[model samples]
Target: MSARSVEVRLVKSGRTKIRYGAELLADDGVRLTVRAPWAGEGGRDFGFVRFEPGDVFTEHYWRDRWYSVKEVRTGDGMLKGWYCDVNRPVAFSGGELTAEDLDLDLWVSHDGATVLRLDEDEFAASGLAERDPEAAEQAVQALDELELMARLGKLTDLLA
Candidate 1:
């Protein structure tokens, strides 16, 4: 199929957190891949990593998976790292893809030496455990699985 523009909407607590346009790269029944530019304004420096303009994101989302993996790269095609988000399985309809963020994330650095689990405090504060224990547990499991893959230098397998 020819490339098409798609909007990616990230939802949290029944609200849209962020939305951006991307180019649909591929779709294989269960998985969808898209290419997008960094959606944040200016740059964000988290001490351990920085996301800026000119960065590219090759994002993969699965219909049967609890998480999405994004390969981040510099403008010149240099590898930066992978950013994984624990979320509900993605849904695509009306030319848009939507995912409900679970407030949990994993960041794997370029060399796979710095794997960080992020937003645990937020996840705890979100009260997901009280509201939906099963989803909360699945989110945690997804984060753990991503971390293990990063440490084992197998994170790319998901992208493949």
Candidate 2:
């Protein structure tokens, strides 16, 4: 049979609403390989730094975890860095794949140095712990593991 592919959507969960962030494509099933679209905001400003809109990312996901590692690149194919999201593993159904971004993130620069941890405050304010304690704990654990991996320069291996 031919390989299966499904549309991927990243949803930002809010107190009373869900915001659609980006739409992409992913290989079907539990372990998904997603190709996320370039940022339409012309790049995202992380406060400390910014990524150009031309930057594209490829994400790797496992169904039983809390994070996904995304390899970021420039429009000209230059490797920018690796941006990882601490989120729910992923769920696929009805021809669409979805993931809940848990707010915490780890960014490892292309050279493997300059790792930046982002959005902890937002995560704390998210009330996720109160809503789903288990998932919140899992998300924190995932962030810790990702930070360790990025520090050890092992994140690049995920892309392969």
Candidate 3:
């Protein structure tokens, strides 16, 4: 099986002069969208990555997040899987989570779109609020993967 990589960078951090953001570097040099916090980190800093989810949650403030590789499954078969997440030490809802809160869950989709599944009911009726919000976005800029591949002299060879 073929594979790819997702490396998380401290685009945005508590220790940086500029506001924090996360960079998703695909194994193929595809960079996903770099986004700033709708809010911002309260005290967290540092970052880490894990292949599979585990009980290893960080209690201390971290400056970075973790990246996990995911397969890019296609109906035809599969291309490859490479993805990451900024919720390593899983971040909690930064503030009070309520139905009004715009919560987002990040996941890589087959169509190359960064999938954000919003849980309105959870935010509205549950205590999943008043916590740090996780940094969410697609592993790479969806529209740019192909463009980037071409620039690197790759795309054409990726045919099924």
Best by lDDT: 1
Evaluate all candidate structures by whole-model CA lDDT and list the values in order: 0.94, 0.75, 0.27
Worst 10 residues of 1 by lDDT: 1-10
- When sorted by TM-score, best at the front, the candidate numbers are 1, 2, 3
lDDT of 2: 0.75
lDDT tens digits by residue: candidate 1, 7-107: 99999999999999999999898999999999998999987889999999999999999999999999999999999999999999887999999999999
Clashing residue pairs found in predicted model 1: none
What lDDT would candidate 1 get against the real structure?
0.94
lDDT of 2 by residue, 1-160 (tens): 1235455577778332232233344544566776655644566677644677667667787788789888888778888788888878788766566777899998888888788889999999999999999999999999999888888878766656
Error of 3 at 71 (Å): 2.7
Regions more than 4 Å wrong, model 2: 1-5, 14-29, 47-49
Q: Write the per-residue lDDT of candidate 3 for residues 75-94, one digit (tens) a residue.
A: 33443222322223222223
Rank the candidate models, highest lDDT first: 1, 2, 3
Q: Report the candidate with higher TM-score, 2 versus 3.
A: 2
Top candidate (TM-score): 1
- Candidate 3 residue-wise lDDT at 115: 35
Q: What is the lDDT of residue 144 in candidate 3?
A: 39
